[model samples]
Target: MAPKEEVWNPSVETVTPVITLSFYFYPTSTTGVVIQREGFAFSYSEEFEQSEWVAYSLSSLDFSNRNFNRPFFIEDPKVKSRSADWRNYKKSGYDKGHLCPAGDRKSSYKAFEETFYTSNISPQLHEFNDGVWNRLEQKVRYWAKKYDGLYVVTGGVLSDNLKSIGEENVAVPNYFYKILMTKDGKKMIGFLVPHEDSEKALYEFVMDVNTIEKMTGIDFFPKLPDAVENKMEKSNDYKEWSF
Candidate 1:
């Protein structure tokens, strides 16, 4: 389901934290339990034992160029259904791949550390995580820098009877997908990538957001007007984004 738009009046007294402004771009969550964090928000899938999708804004101001020592993955306190354990990936021959990449959160130590939470990870091949996926992430950083900022949503395509790993039987998705758009919702792009390592250029995986929505049953960018949303979601034009 598309996220319901929340109108917050700053003058109104409220005890709860406001949802991040970026939440406007969140996709539909099939498995439910959407968790909000200071740095990002994600819809956790109890059935898959991982986030179905992680949504965050990448801002040019967020790249602080600071390096931090990696931290151990831990269960997300916000997830009502306990997130999968980091140990599940132990000797499982799959890397604990990050959905919201650590590199994107270097603006603060807390933001960087939040990416280590177990709910933010999925199983991935070593080469795939370090190679093609990494490449796509770098390209995103480039776009974020060029365009000032972007709303990004990413996750594996979770489904039934897939090869699973870990004591919790963490599902290893056959494919992963990412969608990005400017804050104004004028430009958009999506990529659906195979699970294994690949030498193919990143653009080769370029897909329209509508196709991905059909494949994953997620309604991306519901806040856009129907005219704009329909047109943007139907495009696979690589020229819109600079490589």
Candidate 2:
């Protein structure tokens, strides 16, 4: 059978202000756009309405490996399940850490649980996710609270070579990345951090939306125009907006 077509439903916009700018939040994740103060603009994925568990089909984007070409469901569960190959990972002393925290997306419980998918996870040391990465995710939330709301996309990077752990297959990402846009749709900021823990790696770096596109091979904001992509790469001013 052909796959189910993803649909987006537009909702009212909510705007709130921060120190430098104001933000906007649409009730649903459907069609929305954000413009940054630095003059970069981006389109967001269609909001997953009716349910928080939106299936982002990896096949939809241009990202590298075909092995990762499957639909990923985002949900929030009380406890993350152990991977089939947990023993192998445990022997290596790594935990199936979540790149996108369940709490950050807790607009709803179901949405929160779906975020626990192993596909969306990476082999991370307990210290890194619990330490620096956790702090960063909190900062993003703080920014969201200060401003109206921020637009965000986060996930692990998968390398070309796929590895098998225990009985399940897993892919190691070269890096993990996240993109945040201010609410008013006027500012966009991108951050890339290595999968390993390092104090120096925590600092935020400037990124073009395309940088993520090139890495994930997924076209994040498919509804947005081409000009937004062009604008994001040229503007470095958004770097100053980082904390």
Candidate 3:
């Protein structure tokens, strides 16, 4: 018989304190399989609550020796704004800025590069991205060391229309989010934090995978039953997550 196709399910778990999140593992054509699900919603402070962006180190995730590349085709025209020009911003000695650092998952250049996907990016000041956000990515790695792994989704909320420099047209985020999961198949946890530089503007509130899909109008883990989604939303205790 042909090899059976592998499947995955969201595994919800609670991290330190009262934080609860969801994540899942899926087969990948190149990497054989990868963790590809995340739970959490990103909304304006006035619209939804926020959370803090913690840092994780590459060493903690055991990816210190791996090579990785940024994701291709990551650009959000909507991320542009009147406050600063892209070209000027680049020349100003600030990188395009990735909320999910490449170093965290440096298994391969492809994996590392995917971190550049516009969907996973935000217009953050160099100091913030390189400093605070970078630290958060490292901290996540530390958590991974103990838990064995984590699947995270993070990004910023675009509240205004800003024009792209070269095109002179308003920019819109092709995807206003970034998701990462672990290859190991134990517990699954995800997070969604804001791109705003202020610590106060980060991860304001938390929600489950279902709530995230509802808020974003996107369908995640389509193979899962409706009851599964429902359960994730209602239960604060993540142990209920199952296939």
Q: Report the C-alpha displacement of residue 141, candidate 1, in angstroms.
A: 0.2
**TM-score on alpha carbons, each prediction:** 0.91, 0.59, 0.49
- What ranges in model 1 sit over 4 Å off? 1-21
| Per-residue lDDT of model 2, residues 81-123, tens digit only | 3223334354656666654454543333433444454433566
> What lDDT does the true structure give each of the candidates?
0.85, 0.45, 0.39
Q: Clashes in each model (backbone N, CA, C under 3 Å)?
A: 0, 26, 40
Q: What is the lDDT of candidate 1?
A: 0.85
State the lDDT of candidate 3 residue by residue for 1-243, as single tens digits. 733444444353323211113222211111111222121211212111111121222224335665443344443232222212334334433356655566654644544654443433344556567655665666566655655555554544333453232232223222233333343433333334444344542233234545445444544434345565454444334342221
> Which candidate ranks first by TM-score, i.e. highest?
1
What would you estimate as the lDDT of candidate 3? 0.39
TM-score of 3: 0.49
Q: Give the range of the ten consecutive residues with the poorest summed lDDT in model 1.
A: 10-19
Q: Is candidate 1 or candidate 3 better by TM-score?
A: 1
> How far in Å is the alpha carbon of 40 misplaced in model 2?
24
TM-score result, candidate 1: 0.91
